[model samples]
Target chain A: MIENEFYSQQNVGPYEYYQVGEFELEEGGVIPQLQLAYRTYGTLNEQKTNAILVPTWFSGTSKNYESYIGPGRALDENEYFIIVVNQIGNGVSTSPHNSGSPIAMEAFPHIRIGDDVRAQYVLVTEKFGITELALVVGGSMGAQQTYEWAVRYPDMVKRAAPIAGTAKNTVHDFLFTQTLIDAITSDPGFKGGRYTSHTEVADGLGRHADIWAVMGLSTEFYQQELWRLFGVESVEQFTQGFLRPLFQSLDPNSLLTMAWKWQRGDVSRHTDGDLAAALNRITAKVFVMPIDEDMFFPVRDCAREQALIPNSELKVIESRLGHFGLFGAEDSYFEQVDCYLRELLASP
Target chain B: MIENEFYSQQNVGPYEYYQVGEFELEEGGVIPQLQLAYRTYGTLNEQKTNAILVPTWFSGTSKNYESYIGPGRALDENEYFIIVVNQIGNGVSTSPHNSGSPIAMEAFPHIRIGDDVRAQYVLVTEKFGITELALVVGGSMGAQQTYEWAVRYPDMVKRAAPIAGTAKNTVHDFLFTQTLIDAITSDPGFKGGRYTSHTEVADGLGRHADIWAVMGLSTEFYQQELWRLFGVESVEQFTQGFLRPLFQSLDPNSLLTMAWKWQRGDVSRHTDGDLAAALNRITAKVFVMPIDEDMFFPVRDCAREQALIPNSELKVIESRLGHFGLFGAEDSYFEQVDCYLRELLASP
Candidate 1:
């Protein structure tokens, strides 16, 4: 059986959980308690002026992005109050896989990215009473969530930083996410949502990683040292040796739920009015940073976003370090990012 | 009935029916007349001065690389003579599925990268009747042929340009290719290769495309365009669109043959001594341009190769474009390539 874990510490931050109300998804009328798992780092000032909200990327928890939360990083503990919210479907949050009888495909709710943001909004505003905030920083799917936060509640967020992300589901990300979902939902062991723990889409996940890997690195990276790094001989050893460990780390349920959120990630879709007008309405100071080699979010995407946000600038991370380059590379990326964030904070 | 046609265009160029001799696959015994299907764009001038070998890439043809041959691009037809040779199993050359009887996998001939070069050696020496090649250029699978020519027949190939490709299959490429083969061959519709054209592996092909699309483009590309590209409003529309084309493309016989050939693409396999030592024996001006954003042939892959080759220099094709960028956005790419080829041709 797949194990579901939640964390709550004295001041552990994103590990904190708040029971938001029971919300029903649009597709199936399955009602489940939408308990939000979140974390906060850097204390909120009395005026709540130093708050910066951080949403997650696809298949991510608050934990994955925790490195950027400490002092000297983007969301410095000394400067601003930071909050990292986990979207539903991640094991720490409410997901279909962990529920009782409401787990079948037909029975589970078709939760969208907007729905995820809405749920998180309740946790942020109602429970934490986060009123006027600072920045909404995220990458990949996190970028999607951050965008939603700005568009959904323009008065709340003052700045937006989306890294290695897109405002909408591009054809490439859509296909990859769709394929991954297909891999999980169609897992023979899944028994059409009945099975929870049996190798539910291990091949699919492995395939997903393979597909995802293409955008993560350069051709030079693969040809040169893949076999050597994995310490395997031949293609078979390399494929299995690494993928086996990767498969072990990812839970199938988390993959599926996060995919559902990602597939539905469109801030424009959530808005009733014109997309351009809605985009124009965003008053947040936008800093769109897409890795030069990030396949997930290309420079073209960043260019488009920068064009939309009037008070925005584009920073392309041109390193051989692919998509994950935004996180940390040869320390140069880190230093550049550190400088950029500090300048942004110290600017006005 | 997938309308299978064999085109014989002798009048297009100075052509002759060259019996490709025989191919003894290690999976089985010898098959007579292992014919090669190829085309040449430019004439091989006297003294074989202008000859530049253009080998084929994966899922490519004499037609695919023709764009690079014509004017202004790398291996420009205006300046250098281009020979686009088709590898075995590419329908026209040596193949398994096309073979009348079953060739057992064990005895299938070891058609290594060197073997492909040896076959080209026959095409160049016996058929075209030429010796010194000014340059050997290719991308992806073609790069392997170029590497083989540089190392195996160093005297013939004075310069080499291998782009967006790896020296050998990495775990990623190997798995991707293996998955492609598995999708086609393992389908129940495949019917153990006995079901002649009745059942096609549509799911497999769709799955292959799903896997391939990830490798081909950035996630942003998929996100911004997958729905329209797939021509679907809903998930079902998208699903059917991908599966149909992929399943339809699998000419069972060609797939198996190509898989076999691809598996045997290692150049050092045919060398007398250690592979690295064999590679070091090359005496050519080597230029390996491994794509920086390429997932399959990681930039490091080319770096390792450059380290191995005695006189090799590596150029990273820095672009958000994935593997296909080497072909599509050849703007940033071809200029450097053209200059290199011009310099190579300018040499003694």
Candidate 2:
């Protein structure tokens, strides 16, 4: 991987693009042909055995994930060929944030974890002649799809690592996701989602960040750090000072779509509503890493998943960073992940 | 205890002529003097030694709770005087369901658990001429007020039983209550809650019962009862068949008013946001009877209250009736409650 300079627009490599077929979105019962945008790293050996799949997180770009590459990291570019795919709702892909006149009300296809996996499957086979992956790794919503890939195409993914994700979407996750949706859609300027007004953008984004920060930590942490982070002690102050400003940079419509996709990431939709069976079908080796203190998705949820998956291990990372702990806050997390990959994911 | 004939009422009770005063709704800031409309059994005693305060549930009136009273029950009229008080939001107690005009928006006073305690205090003092209550018993929302009474006006309630009630609301409870509020406020007929049309009444109520039943039970119960109750085997069937019709019977405005009161019934509000202090303020002996299988208001919520109240006993009742089970689903609950009151309630 390139250096941190890659994230700086000055030295970034131009993104190589490959378009997969379109998918039909939700509402009005239509499976429209939706498009996919993606990028890849590393090399295929003579045996074509070094393919690792990594998907992007919620509102996260393929660039944001590039930092974990290079000579010695988890997805070391020199050791394994890593394929990072953009999810449908992110701006670089087919999303409400960057798409044309169909911004909000446009009948964007109702995509799912299944849809995402299938789209990546097309790209993997058509572009690289890869029928199987060494492993699939991702965090948050991206991790959701990774977990789904193991369930949907178990034989194709020899091993999988899903960080801070769930087997079945709980109601609390749905509530938190809904809050972000309301923040965007409730603005009078939203105009039934076909909104172009920047006025609502700030309000929508503000609510998004506030929920993320609040949900990502314990009540004790939120109480202690909210003031220091935003220079405001009260919820109102933190909401305005840090939250509103952070989200204001984002488009409201895009926020809603990303949230919509995140909440609907349950793989049970394909298994005729049997969550256990959907998980039971996962034949790929899995290392379930969940944050201990995450109020949203905790290690308890990981154990529930472990119960159904045939070949699975659980790693509980104790950290106050909550969901963020899965990213970089906890050193043991990264270490634990590396150890698991060495023993379970890195094949003979 | 006019035999079982009382329950099979042609129109419930002599509800029409029964008048105490105006309800003086706590919300909408209405200060109109209200009367207590009630029915009694047994005797008030020359010294009023047998006076038992029975607060109505969310929508229940004097008639519904009166069914639990009579000659041979735990709250036997032969042994104690029983007075069923209409809670403020119930139509019988001067609510939006029966008020001549709306309570006037933000001008409405916020009602807390403390406020309900005060309102009941006024009814007992100004109307009943009773200085002391042998015991106060209620279920669900009424139990909320009962808890307030034990603490807020300790001297007034000698013994109290708060069944299936929580001290402070949980996130799950807040979400459940918020959904009901959204259903009413979102109705186009709501028109900012200015009473635009009664057309929304049925739809709002239907959505309300749906929200209630969904949050009230575990996933296990919903699956079993779907077909027997709704004639179809899924959530959609149970909702359309049972929930919709039950909700249709409710008035939208009354639903809103009651929900607002319930959310505000935070014990923290009463004790300057000190939960433990609020619980400690109770001088009246309390029996914290929580149901084992109540999916929403679990027994753990009362754990704090138990630790706080010096004169409290936690009688854990094992039952599958969920929150409602604490209201005496079987003879076991009735016996437990009756024993607690006869032995402990009659203490100094």
Candidate 3:
């Protein structure tokens, strides 16, 4: 591996590192050398009983999840030793953006939700010597990782909260994710994943962000002029300031890597195509939280999968922010998450 | 102007042509020679009282509207003289693709739904010498024209059926349309609207079509494999076989022109921002028909607008096809249209 310091946890943290060495992916690919970039807030007590594993979502970093940690919030670093682990393709991890030639861009092998969970398992069990988690928590693709962690290693995860995502990606969501991928690759500047920099495919990234304007938020979000809350007056301004810049700042190949994993996100893949059986294997208590207005992962879809999970409870988060609600757009959402987490932690 | 017969009504008929010289657009620009292409399925009756006008939707041609204009259909050519006018900028009509200098590609002046309705008015009054229309009917962007006709030339249209669209585009729909536009313009191949062939921006068109895959249809449409109705098994097959080719065949600049018109589709623009007043101006008996699953123009949005039209009846067509339900995907939808149109025409 190239091992660039800029992508290392030390550079992006209050952080730490776990070297998994040669990591094998769920989809039959291998990284010759793998490093997981993670950040830990607060301290791990003697018993390691307060540890919470927070997995990064698609196109997200451990830094972004830092907001949910700290003193009084849901993760509450004051009480819990929160570990925010970056997913493989999110640039800061063993991603196409920072990996060696054999596993970069066009050659970056397929990854899955299970692969990330397995890596997190290695980190939890081998590196920290922590065998059980107080909670496995994340949203969107992070939520996917949470589900994978609980289902794949049930006893290790005492409780899990998969927010704004499903155990198995729905066909509708697959199509949406596919469209997003198409938006990027179709940019001629993408150059078949051989672009020199993210700017080369800026237009592609812009279009990809444009898809988010439609799929990632509710109609009421635009109708109520919530873009104004972000300090932009027009849709053009919102796109320019927030939507376009966010996607353009990330590597195109990195995005493609995460997107492919997102599309193939089914714990059932390991359980011989039986989703209920896969969900049934999860012995950990699960809080299945879905945003009411999330068009991509509608609550109805989450409710369906929640029914299949034997020890899961469905907790619907009402928010006009839609899938982006996990970002703390509304105060009530944070309160809801705090309440849900408190309840999950308090349960016998 | 380059009056190639392929672009003219001569080659693209069952179509006729009407020249409206030196036409001024709504947004303060003029076309030196504007020609409206049209197709009439049945003969003009002696009284001309039976003439019904059908306008084309975005990217649609008069030929495509032929399906709704037969003996037993909505327009029922046997009883009505159905005139299917191709909307301006739809390639076959006077458009950026086939127009001369100062009006091609990037130079093409913004054309509004009102401008199209204005052009159609000339075609109806001057060429055909039709004093009154038995009905003015269309779907999607065609429905915008329908609303414009009823509001602008109220007495001239006896009845109007605007299907699967709204009197004014909603903020959500506008954002969706903007994304579609961005998807095209962001293509580096577009080169600021100076591309050689449509193939140059095939990727852009493909991405644009990808947005439609999300916005133009419902989840049930994908889940039930309604794409199979068009002879495709996978979503990829549907994208390749239908969606991409359909947009690619049309001119990008022309598509943009129509999209711009579609986005600014407010009859309230003519009635001083009072939508209810604009709708109330309709002397024609109106049938405000919306597709049940249409995300673009949801039934709730349609119902809200329809409530403003004094002589209108709200007819909801139940289907899982979303906005595409207007394309006669289900025989039930066609039957609903047939019944609605028959009822409207029969009313005093």
The candidate that wins on lDDT is: 3
- C-alpha TM-score for every candidate: 0.77, 0.74, 0.91
Better of 1 and 2 by lDDT: 1
Runs off by more than 4 Å, candidate 3: A1-12, A42-47, A70-72, A104-106, B1-13, B43-47, B101-106, B188-191
User: lDDT by residue for model 1 over A163-279, one digit each (tens)?
Assistant: 777776665666666766765554456566555653555655665565445445544445455344435675455456664445435666667777877876776775564556667
For residues B1-348, write the lDDT of model 2, one tens digit per residue: 001121122534544223444444434454454444566767778897778887776655676665476676778988888877766645555455354433433223444555556766776777668889888888777778888787777777788888777667654454346656765565445666555344444554554554455445433344234234324566556556755665565556656766777766666666788988888888888888776656556677666577788888887766544654533445665776677666666577
- Most accurate candidate by DockQ: 3
> In terms of TM-score, how similar is model 2 to the real structure?
0.74
Chain B vs. true chain B: TM-score per candidate: 0.82, 0.83, 0.96
Q: Score residue A195 of candidate 2 by CA lDDT.
A: 55
A177 Cα displacement, candidate 3 (Å): 2.3
Q: Write the per-residue lDDT of candidate 1 for residues B7-103, one digit (tens) a residue.
A: 1243122322356687654444465666676777766777777788887776556666655766766566676677778776554455544455434
Candidate 3, overall lDDT?
0.85
The global C-alpha lDDT for each of the candidates, from Candidate 1 onward, is 0.65, 0.64, 0.85
How high is the lDDT of residue A230 in model 3?
66
For model 1, state the Cα shift of residue B325 in Å.
6.6
DockQ, Cα level, model 1: 0.35
- Best-to-worst ranking by lDDT: 3, 1, 2
Winner of 1 and 3 under lDDT: 3
> Per-residue error at B28 for model 2, in Å?
11
The model with the greater TM-score, 2 or 3, is 3
